[model samples]
Target: MPLHRLLYTSEARLSDNASGADLMVESIVAHSQANNEKRGLTGALLYVRGTFIQALEGPLDALENTFERICHDFRHARLTLVDMSPASERMFERWSMTYLAQNDEPARLLVNRDLEELYFTVSTNAAEAMRQMRGLLLGEGKKPALEVV
Candidate 1:
C-alpha cells in the first residue's frame, strides 16, 4: 500500500548525565516496533541522547493515530512535528524503529544529501543529530554497547 510520510523533530533538555540515553531509546524504538507490527506501519526511529527525530510512513489513518501516541509519548523532554510528506516506498520494511548515536558530522551530512537527492524521510536524521549532540553533551561514546539479543 502507498504511504504518507510524517516527519517530526523535537528536543528537550535532558538531565546533564549519561544514563538517560537507554530509557530514551527504549521509549520509542521498543514500543513503536511492537505497536506498529500488528498494524502494518513501517518506520524508523533515531533518538539522539537528548533529542528524538522519528520518521513514520504508512496508511494515513494508521500514521495519524500513531503520531498522536508519539506526541503524547513522555520520553522526550520536548516534542515537535517537523513535516508531512509523501513517499513512493517505505525506507524500513519491517514495522520497527532503531536507535543510534549521532557520533560525528558525517551522519548529518549524509542526511542532508539524502534529503536532497533520495526521496526518503528526514525525521530520523533529526534524531541522528540529536544523538550526536547528546553524546557530545555527556562526553562519552568512546566504546560500543554489547548488543543484547
Candidate 2:
C-alpha cells in the first residue's frame, strides 16, 4: 500500500518545570516508539517553545487513528492539521518515532530559525516544517538511540 503523511502543530501543555517537561517528553517518546512500530508508522517529532510539530507517515487508517488519539491527549491543545496527503515515501522510515526537543543536539538547527515565527506561519508552511525536521534528523549524522527493527 502507498504511504500517507500527516503533519500537525499544537500547543504543548507540558509541565512548568523544565525537568518535569523532560520526563514527560521522554515518556511520550518511549510510548510512541512502541505504538508507532506496531502500527507501521514512521515520523519525527519536534518540541520547542511550547509547541509540537510532528510529521507522521503510514497507512491512512493508522495515521488517522494516531491523529485522533493526539487530538484527545491533554498534553496537547490548539491542534492544527498542517498537512495531510499521499506521500511518495516515508521520510523517517528507519525510526518508529524520532524525538527532537529544544535541548537535543539536533535541535541546534532551530536556534538560528525563529520558532515562534514558524509556529505562527506553520499552517501556510507545512512543507518547510517537514523539511526542517528532516534536516535536523540528518544534520547530527548519528543514528537515533531508538529505531524500528
Candidate 3:
C-alpha cells in the first residue's frame, strides 16, 4: 500500500538576537534532514534574511505528531503555521530535507547576520506548521499539537 503524503509550509517571527540564531537554524536544518534520511521523509527549509519559509512533505502521521514536541521545543518565539496541503510533487528528491536561506549573503558573514526584525513582524506559525508536518509524517490517529499535552 502507498503511504499518504502531506506538504506543510510555515512562516515565523522570532525574537531579535545575535546569539543562538545561527546555531539554532543550523541545528534545525541538520536535524530535519537527518530525521528524514532515517525515515525517508522529504522536506526543505528556506530563510530570507532572518525570516523562515519552510516546506515539508512526508508520511501523514509522524509529521503531524512532531508538533507536540516542537511547541515544547520553544527554541524560537512567535512560531506560526501558514500552509498545510497535500503536495502532488516532491520538492526534494533524495535528501530527507534541504535547507536554503534567503539572506543576501550565502557565506558565514552574510548568512550569519542577526537581523531579527525581518521575522519579528511576520506571523507566528512555524511551530504550528511544524506540528502539521509531523502529522503528515505519522499519519492518521494523530491529534493536533495543542492536544498532545
Candidate 4:
C-alpha cells in the first residue's frame, strides 16, 4: 500500500497545568496507540506551550480518516494542516503514537520560537518539520538553529 505522512499543528484547549497536560497526553497516547496499531499507522505527537505538533504516516485513506477525527476533536482548536504528501517510508515506524511533553529538550526547543512563527514555519516548510521531528525522536539533545521563514 502507498504510504503518506500528514503533519499538523493545533492549539490545545486543555488546561496548561503540568498535571492536566500530562493526563491529557497520556490519554491521547493510549487511545492513539490502540487505534493506530489496529489501522497500521505510526506517528509522534509533541505537546508544547499549549500547542500540538504531530506527524502521522499510513495509508492515504487511514491518514485522512484519522485527520478528520482530529479536526472534530473538542480538545483542541485552530487545527492547521501543515504538510501532507506521499512518504517513501515512515519516520516513526517504531511508535504507534509516541508522545513528547513540553519539558523535553526537543519540545522546548521547538516552542522556543513564538507560536505564530512556529506555525508559519511548519505550514510553509515540510522539510523543516521533518527535520525537527526527526531531531526530537533521535534525541539530538541540542536545539536546531531553525531559520524563521
Candidate with maximal TM-score: 2
Per-residue CA lDDT of candidate 1, range 1-149, in tens? 66877767667444455567556555556777788876778665544434556667778888989888867766554577766666677655643554444444653544333323222233345444333423432234543222211
- Of candidate 3, the 10-residue stretch with the lowest lDDT total is 140-149
Instruction: Show model 4 residue runs off by greater than 4 Å.
Output: 104-120, 140-149
lDDT of 3: 0.50
lDDT tens digits by residue: candidate 2, 1-149 = 98999999889999999899989988888899999999999998878678898899999999999999999999999998989999998888878988766554563544434344555556678777777567556654444432212
Model 1: residues >4 Å from true position, as ranges?
12-16, 103-149
Candidate 2 weakest lDDT stretch, 10 residues: 140-149
Better of 2 and 4 by TM-score: 2
List residue ranges in candidate 3 displaced over 4 A: 1-19, 104-149
- Per-residue lDDT tens digits for candidate 3, residues 1-149, read 12334332344444466446667777787887777676656765656554455555666566666544554555534456555556555544544766544443444332223223223333455444444334333333533212110
Q: Is candidate 3 or candidate 4 better by TM-score?
A: 4
Local accuracy of candidate 4 as per-residue lDDT tens digits, 1-149: 99999989899888568788678878888999999999989998876667898899999999999999999999879998888999898888878988765454564555444333544567679767766776656556655444211
lDDT for predicted candidate 4 compared with the true structure: 0.77
